[model samples]
Target: MKFSTYFNDWLYGQDGYYTKYRTIGKGGDFYTAVSTSKFFGGSIGNKAISTIQSGFLPSDTTIVEVGAHHGYLLADMIEFIYTLQPQLLDTLTFAIVERFPHLQEQQKKYFKESFGDAVKLIHYNNISEIKLDSAFIVANEIFDAFEAELVYTTQEGIRKNVVVTNHQLGFEPCDDLFLNAICDKYGIRQGEIALGYETFAQNLAQNIKKFEFITFDYGEKYPRNDFSTRIYYKHKVFPLFQEELNLNELFGKSDITYDVNFMHLIDSFNQAKIKNVSYQTQLKALVEFGIITLLEILKEKAGESAYLREVQKVKTLLEPTGMGDRFKVAIFRKESHA
Candidate 1:
């Protein structure tokens, strides 16, 4: 089977990791910015308000989150937005784009418990289902979750893709025109390339007449020469290609992920008529979104002990050698083509 097929099943199949067993935070396979601090979501809430006030988005625009795990990020954003601008809640609608029924139930339960009857949440099974005139879309660590294809160039300049055969992963030449063209266009000889970004972008372009899109994920703008795919099992990192590693034993049990190639990602959206507004490190983006100001407000309202505890957690989101520098924030905008 092709690696993308194998990968998609392992992470998203009916009984896949995300479908039944995926967990996030310190106890799970990994920690996301959402798990680090509510301030992460709070910062984004600030940006949302600014966008609406600056006339970039309408007041009634839906705040949509794609691949919202447990709906924590969106919930936190709503909480912070309520704290900052409760009046805006009267106009804005909230929604989550989640594919799996089980995950959707989980998100619904979380939202209900978090806000009770105060907020009305909409659910969609796919991006293509969103039929909004305008939207403010946010996706955190979502691109890395998309199925990816690994490809490399041969000595004769032939392109080959990685696949799973006989329970072992190996590389072979294939007839994937899209991957071939993308590799050639970007001068990418070898790396794990995310699939479906163009389709995802195009779906948003077609479904939502006007939109502002923001996503946070770990990656570089340029393609990496070396493979970045790895496995996370109980917070322990395992190199995907390590010899003696049993691929079958880890199937559907471990989280498999790779760094994104943002250049390819931005270009994909660009081709779909969604233009990128900015791409920057998580540190810069969070600071600009007023994470520090939110922290100060918490310190004053929540007391010193609570403030100290939260600050330490927030540091992980802004740590120089860690999430701060490793993760990136990409923002894109699309106005009515008509």
Candidate 2:
């Protein structure tokens, strides 16, 4: 079947891919930071709090989170903010923009149980509907979901690869104007193939007027010494699935994701004129924002020897060569005119 057909069939509404993956777990298809540990959420909460306290607050200031899978991070933010300043929690408005209805329903259920009507949960199917203005937008593991167009460079010129045969899943080269435009913008010459993440990044950045944007994912900048793309499957990196992994199989049926292009993201932000850009690994951002302090709180709450072991596991998440380094944090802040 064609990709569009397959995607439509497997990912329609409640009876499709969204519901299928909702049941995933330890032995199931995939896992994210939220699935791994609450520490990730705690660390993000710390950053959000710091951002809010550091002069980004307006009377209408809001926290807009994209890809709020299972509302784990939202719950952490609400709980952490309540602990820090209960008054602010009352003023805080939480908006969750999710694509899938089933996931949005899950978010509603979780928020209703956690905060009742105190937290405002706004669900959206498209990013275009997200209104900006003094909002902090957080997207964890969200960039890789943007559909990428494949391109290959040849001795003659550049060629765009389009799926030609569905049964064999064969790719054929064609001349696509949009792909050519992207190649020109990125200065990709002959004999080079690249993903279209840069274009997606640029589109996302251009849509927002005023907001603090941060993306957490595993990806590298362009002009890499390594020629291979970074893709993960089943909590492990596999080479064979790097280029040909199907989106339906990767996200809907399994836990697979590609590393984002951090340099491209930075460049896109620059082109969009969004200022105060900062890039760090997730671990560094966490430590700089006081994740250790949160762990101490967790330790105090547990007061058990086993909790120390859990702390060690969480510490490993911050190691430079581990998830801490693999996962990056990119932030862009829009200054207010008033």
Candidate 3:
């Protein structure tokens, strides 16, 4: 089986480890900016409200969150809108586009306790199923957890990597249109090109009819030095499954994600007729989204003693070498103007 197949199965399969694991936060494999600080989600909310005030997206536009991870981000967003733009809440729709069984349970509980009937839980198995006509779609750390097609480029030529045996995964020469397409698109050099993101982006584009789509992920639009699949368990790198040593990590019990290429994403969206694109670092995006003001509000609510803690929370999301520098935010406006 291919790595994507194995990966999809390991994470979402009925017998998958994610079904039994809480693989997020300080206690889990890794912490996302959303999980690290509630401010991250609140900042997203502020961005949404600002966009609405500026008429980027209509007030009645649906806010669809893809792969929301227990709906924590949406919770923050709902609370922000309630506290600041409560009237907008009545007109707007909060839709959580999710599929994971384990996450759904947690999301349902969170919604019940936090948001009540404010959110519309859309049950979707595929990303395509979660469609929108006019909305603002927030996909935080979404693109990274996707199927990546690994290609090996040698002096001879490009070759697609595949699983040959249980012991080792091997490479097959690039002779097909798929390899040619990727080579033409990304201008692959004599190194390695792992792309399956193109298809993923293209598929997502179809579902987005008209929206301000924002993606937060790690990696560049241009290919740099990236050649490894990451698996984290308890905040450490969990070794990939092998036939030799006993990799105790349960199948899909950890977080398996790869770097995202925003270049590939932009091309895909443009090809699909989505226009008006811009990119920025997470720090910049949050800054532009008014993270400082949001932090002050948090500080006031949490108290001065807790305010410093809130400042650190904001810093964690904005610091270099941590999430700030590593994480990138790409905003694609389907329309050039309101």
Candidate 4:
């Protein structure tokens, strides 16, 4: 089987890692920006409100989140938006695109516990199910989750794909024309190649006539020369192809992810007529969203000890060598309705 098939089954199939794992916080397999701080969502909320108020998006635009693991980010975004402009809540509808019924239920339960009847949330099984004239879609670490093919170049400049057989991983000459074409186009000789981005973008464009899509994930604009796939287990990182690591033992028991190729992502959305509005590091995005100002306000209002604790957590988000630089934010929009 191709590595992409193996990856999809291991991470998203029945009894897969995401299907079985319930924890995603400080104690979980890994930490996302959501788990790192509420302000991550708060910043997004601020941006959304400004976009709506500026006439860029409609007043009743549906706020949709794709791949909302446990709904923490969306919840926090709603909370901040409510605080910033409570009246906006009356016209906005919140929705999440979640494929798993169990995860959908978890999201609903969390929302109910957080807002009761104050906020009504809608759930969709996939992007194609979303229907709206105007929408503000947000996703964190989503593109990286799409199944990617592992490709490498041989000494003779021949491209080959990784395969799994008899519970062992090996490589064979690349036979897929599409995979070869993608690598050739991107000048990628050795790296993971994600498929289905074009279909995903097309689905969004077909269902939602007009929308702004923003996502945060780790990757660079240029193709990497080496593989960026890894497994996360118990907060420890394991390179997927590590010699000592047994792929069979970790199946359905750990988180698997890869760095996204932003260049390819942008091109796919562009083909769907969605314009790339901006691309920047997470650090810059947060600063533009006024996270530092929020902290200052907290310092003035909250006790010194409480403020200090939050500052420490927020540092994890802003540290130049950490998530701050590793993560990139990409924003796209289709303003036909405007």
Candidate 5:
């Protein structure tokens, strides 16, 4: 079976698809930037307002977020916008493209309790359902979750790692339309290449007419030396070889993601006719929006300890030791000026 298909079975299948398992908190498998600190979303709002006021978007601009979990970032973004630009909130749209029913219900409940009729919400089962004319979109840690292909580059060419049924479940060399495209794109090369093998980006581009879409993921065009594909289960990192056939039993319950290959992402947008694309690290993106000023305010009003605590929180998003270099942000817009 295709790796993406396997991912969908676990992430959206009736039994395996869930976020409530030891996930998203102290007892969870992992913590995101939004869960780490309010400042992360707050800083996003600080720039979102500028984007809205810059007169590039329409008055009825819809702000859509894919892979929004529990509405934490949405809540924080709206709150920050409310504090700084309250009037604009009255003329905005909030939409979430989520597949999991549980998370959709949770986000719906949050919006209902928080904004009432003040905000317009449109929920979609997938990005293909989006029919917006223009919008501002934000997706944090979204692209990495897409399925990836583990291919061993041999002297002949690139061979895909596919799941096959032998004695039990084992991996074998398989080729399909998707894998063929990967080999054609990368050409015959030697070395192990973990291609982020999903079409979610292309699907999103084909659906949305024009959007100021932004995605934050971890990956690079080139690697320095050691490159490996691993899985994370409640913060434990294990190689793909270890799981083998048992990957379904293990990773099905946990989050399975891979480092994004931005080249593929950029190519997808270009194919979909999206223009004015740009990229930046999470640290530079946050700093360019000016978060240090916010830190200074906390320092004067609160104690130094509180300020230091805030600094630590900001570091998680900015410091290279953390998500700074690990996470990257890519922006795609319809116009060249934006």
Candidate 6:
């Protein structure tokens, strides 16, 4: 069976696809930036504070977080907000949007134990239903999850819907309208394969209004050959993996993600008429706003080693060749509704 077909069957059926993913943790398939260190949350929290202060009335602001895995960052933001501006804490409401049921339950458990009823948890299967008048939206590593159409260009013309159907999965060309539209928009010529992160990013930008968007992900601009139709399973990167296979079985129940093009995101933001967009690494943004200063304050509450580790993690986020450079942070702001 084709990899995509197998994946659809396993994920849709009562098989162990979702069950296996529910158990992903510290020793699971891979560790996210959040799991790697607390500094990631601390640095992001610092950015969130600056964002909130710049546009909204803290007393009536709603901070919405998409793909809020484990709720650690949300907790960190709450603490940071309290420390910086105590008055905003009482009026603040946090809405965590999580898709996975098991993870949502875990988040609830953590929030209930630590924050009581202060935080509001919302389960969303799609982004279309999220309604907001004036809010600050944050999505970390969320765009990469959008299912993308794959196209391969040849001397003859652009081929669409490339699928693998051999003993081992590979690419076979098909005629898909959506894929063709992407090719037309991007001017991807014959003899080149292109993925559809630009289309997905543009759609997301058009959907939401009346808020500042801060997205963290990894990708590059156009004319970049680094992004291929590939899959990462169990920390192993594979170029020929298709969507029809049992992802959990073939990849050891890991999370499959794609690289996001930051330039495409900037273009989308401009198309949406969301003026005032800033792009930087997570570490640079944190340091500019004094994340080290926050660490010093945390050292008094926690131990020195814990504080230092957090600072180091933030520093790692700044390394140009490391996550700091690989991962790009884009911030978009609209005029405040209030």
Q: Model 4, 179-298: lDDT tens per residue?
A: 989998999999999989999999998899888899999999988889999999899999988988888888889899999999999999999989999999999988887788777777
lDDT (0-100) at residue 20 of candidate 2? 50
lDDT of 3 by residue, 143-257 (tens): 7766655555676654555543452556676566765677666775422344455565566667756688788998876875336566777787744533453333445566777
Give the worst 10-residue stretch by lDDT in candidate 1.
14-23
Candidate 6 backbone overlaps, count: 15
Candidate scoring better on lDDT of 2 and 5:
5
Listed per candidate, the RMSD to the true structure in angstroms reads 1.2, 4.2, 3.1, 1.3, 3.4, 4.3
Error of 2 at 85 (Å): 2.2
Per-residue lDDT tens digits for candidate 6, residues 1-338, read 43344334333334534433343334565556666666566566666677667755344667777878678777777767767776776766677777667777877888888778765655655555665556677787866655444455666763644344433444566565655665676665422332444553444454554677778777655534333444555566655344455533554244555566565556666765665467876656656656677778888888899887777765666678667677777787765331
Clash number for candidate 3:
1
The collision pairs in model 3 are 221-263
Off by over 4 Å in 1: none
What tens digits encode model 2's per-residue C-alpha lDDT throughout 23-126? 43366445566666677776777777777777775534677788787888878777777776677776667788887776888889999998887877777676
As a whole number from 0 to 100, the lDDT of residue 262 in candidate 3 is 74
Report lDDT (CA) for all predictions: 0.91, 0.63, 0.72, 0.91, 0.69, 0.60
Could you estimate the TM-score for every candidate? 0.97, 0.80, 0.88, 0.97, 0.85, 0.79
Q: Please give the clash total of every predicted structure, in order.
A: 0, 1, 1, 0, 1, 15
Model 1 alpha-carbon miss at residue 276, Å:
0.3
Candidate 5 structure lDDT: 0.69
Error of 5 at 133 (Å): 2.1
